[model samples]
Target: MRAVVIEQPGTVSVQDVPDPIPGPGDLVVAVRGAGICGTDIHLLDGELPYDRYPIVPGHEFYGEVVDVAGDIDRARIGRLVTVDPNMPCGACAECRRGRANLCERYEALGVTTDGAAAELVRVPAGLAYDLPADVSDVGAVLTEPLACAIHGFDGLPRRPQDRYLVYGAGTMGLMMGLLAADMTSEPVTVIEPNPSRRALAESFGMRAVSSPEEVDPDERWESVIDCTGVVEAIEDGLGRVRRGGVFQCFGVTETDAMVKLRPFDIYRNEITVIGSMAVHNSFDRAHRLAQVWGDEKLAPLVTHGYALDDYAEAIRTFRDGAGLKIAIRPGGLA
Candidate 1:
């Protein structure tokens, strides 16, 4: 099998590797489509922890089941599916509380283990979700990220006519905007400096602004989500939310980044500041969204596609501040 391995920091290579085989309660998937995520960039930059060097790095992907372990039905074989990349220990306190996403013993695919940036990958059967017939391979590949966004929204209290603002028009921000649009009529604004990204956000019928300066200081958002993971965006977004409004930090920032906020501001405003990590109890919801939203909704996010062999180029395209979502088709897309 051909796999792209990030041997270490500042290193990536496509090399022949042994095909992944299913373990107990596991399934082997023939990789179809995988997408680059911001976390991947962090991993590459040595910001995120992962297994030792030479790991295949991709978690958001869709594939056909090539094989399965245990007594699972044969019907599952050859079925198109997407996976919940969070592997949780059932015995963990978090899992016992039905919060598997925050499992005390949790290992993420592509992060703790080898991922789908290859010809084949093995994952837990329990983590796999069947893809709807109407869902395209690309959309299926995006279910993971969408699930994360959906979970974040699910955790937040959203009002029907609440004015909302999203910081960062990247994959996570755009998904947040799309989801928020379906739930609220209040103008959903996206703040991003990238012209291409802002244009893309506008094309989705979202109010896109190049900076916070364009947004009226008096215009207070009912809710604000910072997906940029930058200190500046976080501080600025906090100031944009209305009194008593909720501010959700959905992006994972660098460990060293910090922002100084007035504690009195939070106290006086009675604002609620929350951090949303990965998806929990939202993978199925995400799959359902992917199925119903169809290509019409998912189409807006996919701005580039690359062959698996061109892994470096794909990573560069994503890191270049260009596309909203870049797909990595193992065999390349037509």
Candidate 2:
């Protein structure tokens, strides 16, 4: 099996590895597609505390089941499935409170364990969600991230008519914009410094701009989300939240990063500042939403696809921000 191996911090390679064998209750998935995100970069740099070395680094992935372990349903074989990478310890204090995303012992497939950036991967059968036959590989690959975005939205105040201002028109930001547009029946404005991304955002019907100042100076958003994870964007977005609106930090910022915010204003304005970590019970709903959006919108978000051996090029393209959603087609699918 060919897999992308991060042997250590700041080190990665694409090479032949032993095919994964499913353990009891596990299933072997023949990797069809996988999406790359900032989390992969953090894992490569050893920035994530939970990431283990010599692991295959892909979590936003979907594939067909090839084999099943003992005690698993044989009917799972050949079912196209998207996995919920986060496997929280169900006995943790957070899990007991239904906050499993903040589980005391967080175990994610691509982070704490070997992931699906390979020809084959062994994942827990219970974590896999079956996809409809009509779902495109691109749609399946995005379910994980869309699930995270759904979880982010779950923490916000639900008001479809409320104006949304999102930072970073990357895949995550665009997905957030999709959320606003899908719910509000109108486009969401996006702030992205990259001209290419700004243009891409416009294609998604976003009012794209280089800076917040480009928007009307008197305008504010009922929902201001910083999907860039950059402290500058976070701070700028914090100041633009409407008096009684909510601010969401949906991006994965550096662990050591800090931003200054006025607590007095938050109290005086009755503002709600919230943070979303990862997927909770939102994976299924995300797949459903993906079907709705993918019918017309989601497929185009996948602007680039690379073969298994070109994983480095995929990373390069991702870092260069050359495309919207870059994915790895391990099976060499179109």
Candidate 3:
């Protein structure tokens, strides 16, 4: 099988590797469509603490079940499915509390183990969800990220008519805006510096701005989310949250990243600041969202595609911020 292998931090290669074999209760999927996200870049640069080097690195993907372990149902073979790549150690206290995403010994397909940036990959059967007929292949590739965003809202306390302000208009920020619009029954406001991304956001009928200054100076949002993972964006977003409003951080930042917040402001404004991580019992909901908002609503986010052999090109495109979402088709770039 051909795969994208990260030999180590700053070292990557496309090479022939042994075909992944399913373990007990596992399924072998022939990779169909995979997405190259920020996490993949982090894994390549050795930025994530969870990344284990010399690993196949693709977490967001959907495929057809080619084979299954003896304990699994044979009926699952040939089914189109997307997986929740998060593999939590079920015995951990966090897992026992049903907060598996924060498991002490957290493992995932692309981070700690080999992932689907190959002709085939193996994953737990229980984590796989069948893609609905209404969901397009491109939309299926978005399920993992969408699930993570859905989990963001799950951690949030929503109020009817709450206005949302998202700090970025990239893939995650766009998804957050869509979800916020649905929940708040208001046009989600977005701040993006990139003209292309701002155009994409507006094409989705979102109210976008180049800077927060463009919005009414007297106005603040009830809900503010920082999806850029940049210290500047976080700091700016915190200041824009209305009094008694909630600020959600849904982006990933480096270990050493820090921001200064006025403790007095938080106390006097009654502001609530929260952090949201990966998918937490939201995979099924994400699959359902694909059914409801699949090709028409979400697939537009995909603006680029690449062959597995062109993983490096995909990474370059990502780092350049060339598109909204870049898809890796294991079968072919087309």
What is the lDDT for 189 in model 2? 87
Clashes of 3: 0
Query: What does candidate 3's lDDT look like per residue over 137-233, in tens digits?
Result: 7679999999999999887677789999999998999999888888866888999999888988898889999987787877899899999998988
Clashing pairs in 1: none
lDDT score at residue 108, model 1, on the 0-100 scale: 85
Q: Whose lDDT is greatest here?
A: 3
True-vs-predicted CA distance for residue 45, candidate 2, Å: 0.8
lDDT for each of the candidates?
0.86, 0.88, 0.89
1-334, model 2: which lDDT tens digit per residue? Answer: 9999999998899999999989999999998999998889889888888646788999999999999988888988989998989999999899999999999999999888999889999999999989887777677889999999998988878686888999988888888888888778656889998888888788878899998778777788899999988999999998899999999989978888999999998999899999999898899899877877774778768889999999999999988878788889998956
Which segments of model 1 are wrong by more than 4 Å? none
The sequence of per-residue lDDT tens digits that candidate 1 reaches over residues 97-182 is 88888888768888778999888999999889998666676579789999999989986787788888999988889999998998
Kindly indicate the candidate among 1 and 3 with the higher lDDT: 3
Instruction: Indicate which candidate wins on TM-score.
Output: 3
Considering only N, C-alpha and C atoms within 3 Å, which residue pairs clash in candidate 3? none
Model 3, residue 1: C-alpha shift (Å): 0.6
